[model samples]
Target: MKKVKRTTIYDIAEKLGITASSVSRALNNSNQVNEKTKELIIKTADELNYKRNTLASNLRKGQSKTIGVVIPRINQNFFSNVIAGIEEVTYQKGYSLIICQSDEDHDKEIQCVNTLINQHVDCIVISVSADGNDYQHLQNVLDHGIQLIQVDRVAEELETLKVINDNVQASYEAVSHLIEGGYKRIALLEGPQNLSIFKQRKEGYLKAFKAYNVPVIEELIVENAWTKELGAEGTRKLLSLPHPPDAIFASTSDFSALGVLDVANAMGIKVPSQLGICGYANESFSEITSPSITTIDQFSVYMGNTVANLFFQEIGNNDTITKPKIISIKPELIIRGSTKRNG
Candidate 1:
């Protein structure tokens, strides 16, 4: 491969017929260089397409000025919004982000973490995959002296900086709303049990039932039904049962609820009137659906900004070891045609 040489300050100095020291002082915005000379040097540097070596500069200061972000899926609405939010704050602070997708695979998640460690990033922000249970990779990051922060789907055991939604409370609210709206048999579409977020959601579902004195039906609970395909399969089986549920709470994501909607449409079952549905993650498509799916707003972008700001606040003060912090955001239940039964 051919390497195109990068334009450096020296190239600008040569082009502008000036000493390299003068060019360096001007680039650094130092008062040592006169205003007129600084202006001339900057213009010449811009003309030469000169780029400052941020990586080298940061290395000299013993910091990377870069953060490594590991997410389950970049294409997902929630994760994407969070990344955008993190970028919004990090960009203003002159920090660069290195993003990696785990694809919800444990081995791949490990690889992503290892790669980030090798890169020597100042900090790493992660949302563990559904299949991730062991977090030696995360421990290794901390051992390597890299600041580690967990967001959303995180490992509860690891004592680190964490930003997440109160899943149990959110799930409780969603189910409570359904029960209040007259849903007799509310089914649950669950994700991987190993993940703390999913477990908390399931706990919330059970808690709601207990609070209302509703009988728990073991058959109505579907495991590993976090995705649309699995959600659809689970719904197909549920609706086929003689004692089908009157409502379904897709506690994983909005996509799963969308799958429930699809299955209901194909089976000619009426929504809200016949089978009410609720989903987590307030995706854009949720509002556009025919009846509009009732879902939870996790404040994904805000969550991301919070995560980024936390990193800056703690890391800036050199206080990573002093405390283990957990920031929780309350999720909101959005009522839509899918869950609104009142005529």
Candidate 2:
């Protein structure tokens, strides 16, 4: 048996008794070609399984019809949902996606950006890693004449299309919810300060304290306690203090809140009775935890769809709408058992 060679325009043109140039022009919807010829060419091309070499066609057209997406971790629930949303839109627009994960490493993130650039992707969407501070990699994407879109964990310095949640407002609302539930002396577990998301959350926590006329205690604020282990470590320290906090806000993520729950449970401290807990990024597990953790829903899937649409709007429309755009999605606070006082 002979191996089948990939179908080409020449094959289709030959079958239709036409020149290859005619087939090419028709396939490209050139004004020089008649509409009937274009329809016949497309129909025959489809029947012959003549898959146009997207790379070569894109090169000729000067548009790849492909987009690159970079995230901290692909396995994370939030990032995964965002990717799904991006794919939903890009697929509809006949575009392809190349996804890369940075694993929270700045060097790896830089390499991922370079790889995407090398691939000549039309657009590069990114959610910066925790270790990211130097944004030369993100800047390089823009310098390469590629559309740069930052979503979720974005860098503030770069003027690009940014689709993000209202982190400060969401955090403030969550903290306020706890306060309304009679939680005072609320301790906070913060993420890495380098990322704007964490910094905004920290600011919200501080603002909530100031609004309530509660003195901000430096001792209760733990730095870089974004991980489960770090959250546990921070909880141990906070709970050990002679004036231990009555509540804890894991402003990092749900994983950190899980850590707080475990530590409190291990120490025989009843949730909502002794301590109230709140988390960010409403993970699925947050709802299932013994005392379901109250959290902020960032609408990860909706955020992703918004990011994809931003790119589609820019690339699909052949215009010079060059103004840098910023879109902030408001997040909702989900109340659960962990933060509720009355049974």
* Candidate 1 local lDDT, 158-256, one digit each (tens): 999999999999999999999999999999999999998999999999999999999999999999999999999999999999999999999999999
Q: How accurate is candidate 1 locally (lDDT)?
A: 0.93
- Looking at candidate 2, the ten consecutive residues that score lowest on lDDT are 314-323
Best by TM-score: 1
lDDT of 1 at 233: 97
TM-score to true structure, per model: 0.90, 0.88
Candidate 2: tens digits of C-alpha lDDT, residues 1-343: 9999999988988898999999999988899999988999999988888887888889777888899999998877888999999999989989899999999999999999999999999999999999858998888888999999999888898899999999999999998888888877899999999899999999999888888887888999999999889999999999999999999999999989999999999999999889999999988889899899999999999998999899878866776766788999999999999988997
| Per-model lDDT | 0.93, 0.91
Candidate 1, position 131, lDDT: 82
